[model samples]
Each structure stands twice: as C-alpha cells, then as structure tokens.
Target: MAKKVVTIKNLEYEYPDGTSALKGINLDIFEGESVALIGLNGAGKSTLLLHLNGILQSDEGDVEVLGMKVAENIREIRGKVGVVFQDPDDQLFMPTVFDDVAFGPINMGFSEEKVKEKVRMALERVNMSGHEKRAPHHMSLGEKKRVSIATVLSMEPEILILDEPTSNVDPRARRNLIELLNGLDITKIMATHDLELVSETCDRAIVMFEGKIAANGDVEEVLTDSKLLESHGLEAPVLVRLFRDVMNREYIPIRLEDVIEKPNKYKI
Candidate 1:
C-alpha cells in the first residue's frame, strides 16, 4: 500500500469556551487519492479540516502530515497540506489576484521570479491565465474561489484540502470548478454536501456525524446505501437509487461516467 499522506488518530478538539467540536476522528489518506468528507451542518467537518494543517491544535490525540507531526512540524505540514477554507473571502484576502496566489510561496521565501512563475502556472491551471492584476474584492465570487485555489496551488502542496469548493457557485461556475479540480491531478480531501460532485470527483467517501466517523469505504458502495445516507441527513443520488431497483442488483452506479463502462448492462 502507498504511504499514508494524512493520518489522524483519536483526534478530539474543543473551542475556547469548551464547545466540543470533534470527538474522535481516525483516518488515513493515501498519496494522490481523491476522498470526500461529507456531513451535515455542525458536524465538525470544518473543525476536522483545521486539524489537518495545524490551523487548530487538538486537545487530545495527534495529527500528522507528510510523516511529520502537525504540532512540531507546522511549517512543513502547512506547506504539504494546502487548506482552502469554505469561504474564499477567508483565503483570498490580498489586494490582487496575483498577490493572493503568491502569498504562500512568498511566505515560504521563494524569490520574486519564482513566486511570479508559480502564480502564473497556478492561474493557468484554473484557466484564469490573465487575471493577475485584478483585485480579489472586485472579482466575482466564482472567480475569487478559483483564485483562492490558485493561492494554494502556487505553493505546490502534496495534498489539497478544500472545505466547500462548490458552495454558492452558479451551476456553470460549479461545473467549471469541478473540471478544474479534476484536471489538477493532486491528492484531494474535500468536505462538501454536493453529493454530485463527490460522485464525480472522489474515489472514496467518509461520513462524519457528531464528531464520529459514521461511515467510510468505496465511494460507490457507501454513497448508494440509502439507509445509511438517510440516517445521517443525506440522500442517495436519484439515478443511483433508480438503477438499484431496475438492475435488481446490490450495487448502484455513483457517477454518470460509470455508465460508459457497461452501457448495455444497466439503464436509468
């Protein structure tokens, strides 16, 4: 098996006022794999993400990124785990797109030329090749979201952690973001409610409920389990539910792309 890139064990955390945010989360993410962390509001999804890159320290247990402990190796872990917060406004605080994208590399002490190069390459990856001078405040929300991702991409992170990549984006912009993420070819851990995006982008799924990992397994296997989904305030994909009945099979298709593999064997 590949070396675990992100590892957590018995992780428990609480806010300053003693509001328990996470109970105990144990997970392992392999290199270059795409995984989704799905749960309802107040489910500790975002709190768990903060632990990944050492943004918030755990009261008990530990977090390791790239084989280094998050507490002692926060510098290295931050570089390896690029966290794009749920709100782009939280991430893209710089005056201009180029400034925002260049923040990470600049903080890492890259030279001017190198930072500029990284910014350009990251923007190009998001298909926003010429928005360097644009202020983040002036850009639309969708554009700011892409630029926020570019900020992390500029740092060349080993794992991309996105809180909610599709929230509030228009359908067109959401599709564009999906395609952008798909083309990145980097290890990703996304926390989102968009099951459609999860089905299309993630190879595996992990569900969190009240700070506990309620379910974890192959994306198709878990996402199609209507009983499990319903119990956790989620729903099975409509097409997956329909195919489950028509095929008279235990397993259901999770993504439209899967239909191509067995076009005649299954129908919606």
Candidate 2:
C-alpha cells in the first residue's frame, strides 16, 4: 500500500474578515500521486494549498504531511513540503535565477557545494539550466515560473504543491510544463481550473465547490462527468468532450498519451 503523504481531516478555515474559505475538507493524498484540484476562482483551492505547507493555519481541523502534524512540526513540515504560488512573482524575489533556486537549500544549512549541486539539479529538472545569471524580473513569465518551481525543487521536498501553474504561459511553455510535471517522481498537488493540464498531467481530480469537495476520483471519471463539473463551475476538457459528444465515442480517454496510444480502443 502506498503511504499517505498528506492527510486533511475536517479542515476548516476562515479569513480575518469572517469569510469562510474552507469547510470540513477531508482528503488523503498517497505517495507519488499527482492530484489536481479543480474549481472556480473563489473555491478555496489556494487556501487549501497554503495549509499543506503551514502558510495558513486551519481554524478547526488538522493537516498532516508525511506523518508529521503541521501545527507541531511546522518548520520541518515547511522543509518537507514545497508550494509554488499562482504568480511566479510571488515566489521569485531573488536577484538572479541561481540565487532564487539556491535560497531554500542554503537556508536549510546545506554547504555551498551541496547548494550548488541541488541548484544545478533543480534548474536542470525544469530545463532552466544555463540561465543562472539571468535576472528573474527580466525573464518571461514562463521562464520565471520554471525558475520558481526550480527554487522549490532545490529543497527536495517530499510533496510538491502548485497553484495555477499553467496560467499566463504560451502554448509551448504550457506543453513543456505538462511534460516536466508528468516526469516528476514525487507527490504533486496542483490547484487549477485548466482542465487540459489536469487531463494530461494528473491521475486524480478533486473538485471543490463553496469550500468543500464536490467530487474526488480518477481524473477521467471526474472529468467525464459533465454534470458534476458544470455544477461546480468547471467543464470537461476539450478532448474528453469532443470524443464523448461529438465523436459519438463511448470510452473517454482524458490523457493525451492515452488518447494517442490507444486511439483504436476508444472508438465506439
């Protein structure tokens, strides 16, 4: 059995202005699972991701990551779980790409050589190598986003969480990001409304509505349910809907890889 990397039980959160952001959210993310959180703009997805790394404290429930309670082991939890925010600007504050990527490992008390190795490995993972001297503010949004992810990857966290990763990127950048995310070997949780990204990169989907999970299951199953998705301010990915409704197909293949690899099997 896969170990549970993240567990949230009856999680609830409220803003300082008395706005409820999350209500009774219970979820368990197993090791190496790529899960997507899909919902509308105000659906608490960002708030939930914040709780995973101890950025936002829950008002009424608990979150555990890698068998460690977030409240009690916050420092350690932050080190073990990395969160990439929706906007790359929010994460990339260092002067250069190298500094941004090396910041985490350096703060973790790693030696200079170890930090350099981790930075190199992380940048390489994101395909941002050879851009170490580039200033973050001068890079394009897509490049900034990649460097931001590399910053977190340098920490070698057990869990990787991202918000709106595909937003504001070009088509090629989005494709590159999908491929990069798909190749990662750690548990990944992404909060996004980009159904295409979800279909291509994630194995499971969690639909949030009014701060609660409306649906949680296999990505294909959840995404194919147009009724459930529509009710929660979402829609099936274009490919899924195309095959299911227009192509008169019975079996829906959500992932691009699956659709391309088994085209004959999906025919009605």
Give the CA lDDT, 0 to 100, for residue 48 in model 2.
93
- Which clashing pairs does model 2 show? none
- Cα lDDT tens digits, model 1, 1-268, are 7889888999998899978888888899999899998999888888888888888997599888888999999888888889988889988878888888998899899999999999999999988898999988988888988998999999999999999899999998999999998898889999999998998898999999988899999998889888899999998777787777666754467877777787666643
TM-score of 2: 0.97
lDDT accuracy of residue 14 in candidate 2: 94
Model 1 residue 8 lDDT score = 93
- Backbone Cα, N, C clashes tallied per candidate: 0, 0
Per-candidate local distance difference test:
0.88, 0.92
Candidate 2 on 1-268: residue-level lDDT in tens? 9999899999999999999999999999999999999999999999999999889997599899999999899999999899998899999998899999999998999999999999999999999999999999999988888999999999999899999999989999998899899889999999998999998888899999889998899988999998998888787888888888898788887876787788789863
Name the TM-score of candidate 1.
0.95
True-structure lDDT of candidate 2: 0.92
Cα distance off (Å), candidate 1, residue 251: 4.8
